[model samples]
Target: MSNEFALNAEARSDLGKGASRRLRRNANLVPAVIYGGDKAPQSISLLAKDLAKLLENEAAFSHVLSLNVAGANETVLIKALQRHPAKGYVLHADFQRVVAGQKLQAHVPLHFMNQETAAGVKTGGGEISHTLSEVEVSCLPKDLPEFIEVDMAKVEVGQIVHLSDLKLPKGVELVALAHGSDLAVANIHMPRVQAESEDTGTAAE
Candidate 1:
């Protein structure tokens, strides 16, 4: 939580297939773009290795990153990442430049803790199924959370966890809440034996 990775980059003027490929071959840098609000999208390049290391931590996806590019330092959040399917390498990333007071939407990673030894799993052999790993949330740059917490300690068998149930930071709003869809965030289901027992009990009555 305390460590932040900063990357140095320069604005890219020459673009397209030939320019990008040439950049990759000559500099080992990948082409990227940054945009948001009233600002126009700018072409940029980042070191592929540094980007890979950043992706290893889920926090990097949503946390405010200090991007030093084009002779300017910009505070931005990662919006999307494109990877080479076969090589599993980062090809491009989309960054949304943030203004201090403007509201921005970033996909925050979900942290699941205390689920392994929960009562549902220990006593009832419940299977922990997660429907979402990261949740999109809107908030000011300063109000952005490092990650969303899903408490499995309170999750019992047959219980469903929804985005509305999350305890978010002040001013932060989950994207799912506005949609009004009953998306299953997660569920605890009993093992086969317990399921069969309940089925037998119903059949007898």
Candidate 2:
């Protein structure tokens, strides 16, 4: 994946809730902060519409961001985001500085491939249950993956794919498996209704 996420941000001098509210209402900007990596926390604001547009791409979350703050480009990653409770508009965002060769933890989305043709679903008439839609991984910035692929082609009914079952990209490591946890990532099982119907059929026979 190309590292091309760039946003234009303006440094903000104002502080407190009132200032943030004014920036949102009057300036139509989303308040944000940048911290970490030997730099003091800096308050900044970005165009609400622009930020929303940038977020439309799913890769923006895991890929490193190039934030142009007052003409200086800063390499950072999205740490957190706060949205309006009712309207779901972005209220604030947090960014953390990232340095080359330094390892960091990030949650990458999981992509289940070949689920429709999996042996469990095609032959066993089972449903695929995804226990985890995302996974946390530790890797350097260059080794970070936008998403992890979980192949389900050979999965059978009653079989579960755990954290250790996932094939990590080179240089990336699963945080859970590293700590000795083999949590389930996905599984195939018969639906409750189907199980009950089969039980009734067996009794009738």
Candidate 3:
């Protein structure tokens, strides 16, 4: 998370579908835009190979990025990415300018640990089911976490983990919990096959 991701881009004066298509097909560049903050939105293009490489790392999605556009470096967050439906190639990207001390919403991935050693899974013969893989959090850029870890070692069978149960980093807050949702994040339960087998055994007895 401490590593900085930098992409070199160029200001694109040509606008429209035709222009973008030429940029991608001819120059091997992907169309992109930078907006938000006090500055007007700027159209730009990035190398397709370079962007694909950066996206190979999962942390890039949640990490702040430094975009160097024609010698000017700007701090931004990846807001949206558009890819080809069938080919799965990145077609366009949207970058949002971030300011210091301002709270922004970003989705951080969840990392579950100790599943095999959990009381429910080890002793109670239960399965761990993850209801959510990521959650939206509201925090300043500096306080943003790359991923939230949920320890399942103490979780018991039939127990559910909710948004309120998660331990948040300082200055970070779950948007759903703040909005009174308190949604379920994960749960430990008997597998369907085991449950069915137990029911059949009881009926036979």
Q: For residues 1-205, what per-residue lDDT tens digits would candidate 3 score against the true structure?
A: 2344888999999999999999999999999999999999999999999999999977788888989999998788888999999999999999999898999888899999999999999999999999999999999999989899998999999999999989989999999998899999999999999999999999999
1-205 per-residue lDDT for model 2 (tens digits): 2335899999999988999999999999999999999889999999999899889988888888899998898988898999999998999999999988899888888999999999999999999999999988999999989999999999999999998888889999998889999999999999889999999999999
lDDT of 1: 0.84
**CA lDDT, candidate 1, residue 67:** 85
Q: Residue 107 of model 1: what lDDT?
A: 88
Q: Which residue runs of candidate 3 sit more than 4 Å off their true CA positions?
A: 1-4
Candidate 1: lDDT of 197? 93
Superposed model 2: Cα runs more than 4 Å off: 1-4, 200-205
Off by over 4 Å in 1: 1-3, 192-205
Evaluate candidate 1 by giving its C-alpha RMSD to the native, one decimal: 2.7
The local distance difference test score of model 2 is 0.92
RMSD (Å) per prediction: 2.7, 1.8, 1.6
Instruction: Give the Å error, residue 88, model 1.
Output: 1.3
* Weakest 10 consecutive residues of candidate 3 by summed lDDT: 1-10
Clashing pairs in 3: none
Model 1 C-alpha lDDT per residue in residues 1-205, reported as the tens digit of each score: 2446466677999999899888888999989999986888999999877787777877788889888886688777788878889987877788888898988888888898889887678777899999999888989988999998888887888899888777788999987787776567888997778789999999999
